[model samples]
Target chain A: AQKVTQAQTEISVVEKEDVTLDCVYETRDTTYYLFWYKQPPSGELVFLIRRNSFDEQNEISGRYSWNFQKSTSSFNFTITASQVVDSAVYFCALSQWGAQKLVFGQGTRLTINP
Target chain B: EAGVTQFPSHSVIEKGQTVTLRCDPISGHDNLYWYRRVMGKEIKFLLHFVKESKQDESGMPNNRFLAERTGGTYSTLKVQPAELEDSGVYFCASSQVGVSSYEQYFGPGTRLTVT
Candidate 1:
């Protein structure tokens, strides 16, 4: 069974604070994909990042960064200098290579205070 | 390009009632998928469609749920005699078939409330 776990149910932080959202996954497949999606109050799920199993290199895009560690089975996301606009429900998902289905984690709701 | 879209942004129905939800995928996207997130639970896969054919239906909870993609352009998911437990946000996503990076584009989900 493939599963993504996001232990944090919710988190609150002041604007400009850096916050990290943790994600741990369990999968037997050696090659799989990990993803992060953001769901705003509007209810649209926006894709944030997708990382492949073979590539454990960390990624940084503007204020967003992702740390993929295969040894720990973790793919954590970090938002630096967060803004109020960053408030949303974030989901971590896992899928095996060539599988169209995604197994999602219970989302973590992050609230940024202005 | 327009993203995937789902109809009946929100629906409220009585238990045992029938409800139909529709999804229009982005143009040229051949792969469509359905997922649902029940309150307090992780989002789970419902089914998948490749054009007009069902690629995978293993995730469908029960026979009460039926999905159809007639012309391969739009799809419909119908729930007959819906149970209270069936209430959730139903999301539709689409991706191009054979794309190496199979990142699906999602729609604004339909919230179904069964009372």
Candidate 2:
């Protein structure tokens, strides 16, 4: 079974500050996919990023970035110069190949204070 | 394109009552999925439908949960004799066939409150 762990339950950051959310996962499968999602106050989930197992490269999309390190079984997401809109509950998920199911971690609620 | 849509954004039912939730997938999407998030827990998969057929339903909680995708356009999930533990937010998502590597578009979930 694949399990994702996000240790941070809640985080608060002032506007313009950078924040990193830590996520660690355990999976026996050699190949799998990692994903990040954001659920705002409205309770609608929005897909953030998806990284395959083979790719350990860090990714940056605008002010959002993700670091995937297979050696530590960690996939961390960071937001730079964060705005108030960044406040939401973020979840890290894992899925194995040939399976449509995504195992999600308990989300981390981030509050961006202006 | 319009994203996946779910009906009755919220539902309240008494214990032992039967409730059905509906989901309309994106146009031309062949893959549809159902997931739920209970209080203080992560979202868990309930089932997956590829067109009119149920591709995988291993995550369904029990026999009381029945899901069907009729005509391959929309799907319905029926929970009989709902328990208090069944209260949660149910989400529906859909992905286009052969599209950009299984990117699923989600709908605003239905919050089921079983009392």
TM-score of each: 0.98, 0.97
> Taking candidate 1, what TM-score does its chain B reach relative to the real chain B?
0.97
Q: Over the stretch A2-43, how does candidate 1's per-residue lDDT look in tens digits?
A: 989999999999999999999999999999999999999989
Mark the 10 consecutive residues where model 1 chain A has the least summed lDDT: A43-52
Name the regions of candidate 1 deviating beyond 4 angstroms.
none
Model 1 chain B: lowest-lDDT 10 consecutive positions: B96-105
Q: Which residue pairs show collisions in model 1? A: none
Model 2 lDDT per residue over A62-102, tens place: 99999999999999999999999999999999988767678
How much TM-score does chain B earn in each model?
A: 0.97, 0.96
Residue range B24-80, candidate 1, lDDT tens digits: 999999999999999999999999999999999999999999999998999999999
